[model samples]
Target: MTIRIGKIGYLNVLPIYHPLETGEIANDFSIVSGPPSALNQLMDAGRLDVSAASSIEYARHPDKYLLLPDIAIGSRGPVQSVLLLSRGPVDSLHGETIVVSAQTHTSAALLRVLLAEWKIRTNFVTGDATAILSRGERPQAILCIGDEALNLRFHPDYPVRTDLGEAWRTLTGMPFIFGVWIARRDSLDRSGQAVRRACDTLIRAKVWGQTNIASMCALAAERSCLSREELRSYFDGLVYDLGEAEKQGMTRFYRHLAEHGIIEDVPSLNFLA
Candidate 1:
């Protein structure tokens, strides 16, 4: 049986994808790639055996999916890649419309929590950079995540930029996790030995990538249009290990989600053995 795997196609996932892209991982499985939201949808549909998904997606249905251990996309603060841009005073964005990137769920949820905490009221719409940049009347703000957020300049851009990761840390004093690897609960039980292969492969990729970040940053720089130093700094701020502190962060995040009535309840974190 051919094991299926899904990965985020954004630059932020390079460390996870580096080994896979370089053929360091065994080539026995089929790999699917897309934005985090797409991967979440595909995994929910059981079209993917394993995939990276927004952390909130897992929280919403933890009973249906098992987290792949020890790997995640997280930041303690100032995750330069997850940003909210505003053209006016941040406190004054209450009644305005904000264009949110369609590629993420956790970041979008985080934004909602932030707004609610600030007692700010706003409307949201799904949009990409092109749509936001070309609209007749500019959006009061735009929430950009992943690779798209790395390029700070959007055509006809807004003036203010807030790093959502930093905001979360300052507000809650916890690291914010954006993405995690997961698989259908039943899929992990089927034991095509597929999940085993995927887990080993991803762990290997992460190890290799972290060990060679400097070189990886240079290569990513060529494609991302950011200087190698900038890419290095960005990568430096990201944490791949889903350790104790991250688990706490996840718990706190879910609790906040429940408090805000964003989700039905805070699901327990479950993992595949």
Candidate 2:
């Protein structure tokens, strides 16, 4: 059976997916690409056997999925692609409206955590965050993630920009895990060998992609507004490994989420055996 793997269609994941797309690591897997939020929904519905989905997805439903070992999309500081742009200071936005992109979950939740920690109360509405700015209509703030954040990080209308990863690091002093690789538990139970084989292939692909980041940056440059050098620097700040520190970071984030009532409780990380 062909394993259906979910891929996040963003430059941040190019390093991991480039090899698979180029046949550098040959496989018979079927790959489905979408935004992180969409992939999370697909994984929850069992439409995807495995995916790189929002970390919150796993925290919310730990019983239904097993994490892939040693892989994640995270950052120690200043993840340039997850940002909050504000017309005024973030602390001053109490009771003001903030336009949040409908394409994210983890980042949006992280924003809420940060706001709560700062004792700031703000209204949130899901819509086209960019359109408000493009149309010269300034909301109190706007939240953007993935390529949209990268594109709007420097927009002049919002001078007060906060990088969510940077804020999380300042708050927790740990790496911020945005997305993680997960496999539906039932799929593994039914096709353990195929799932494991696909996992191994993914690990190999990650290793290759990390080593060939320059090539990946070249590919990203052609499609993005940033130059090759800028893309390299952006990728440099991203963390792909789920090591001890990354695990601790994830746990810390879960704790904050639980404290803010964003999640029921801090769920334990369960990896595929």
Number of the top-ranking candidate, with lDDT as the measure: 2
**Residue 228 in model 1: lDDT:** 91
| Model 1 TM-score, 2 decimals | 0.95
RMSD of 1: 1.5
- In the range 61-117, model 2's lDDT, one tens digit per residue, is 999999999999999999999999998888889999888999899999999999999
In every candidate, how many clashes are there?
Answer: 0, 0
Candidate 1 lDDT tens digits, 92-210? 89899888998889999999999999899999999896555656657778898887788754434577888999999999999989989887877878874778777878888888889
Runs in model 2 lying further than 4 Å from the true structure: none
- Candidate RMSDs in order: 1.5, 0.8
Off by over 4 Å in 1: 134-137, 153-156
lDDT to native, each model: 0.86, 0.93
In candidate 1, where is summed lDDT lowest over 10 consecutive residues? 150-159
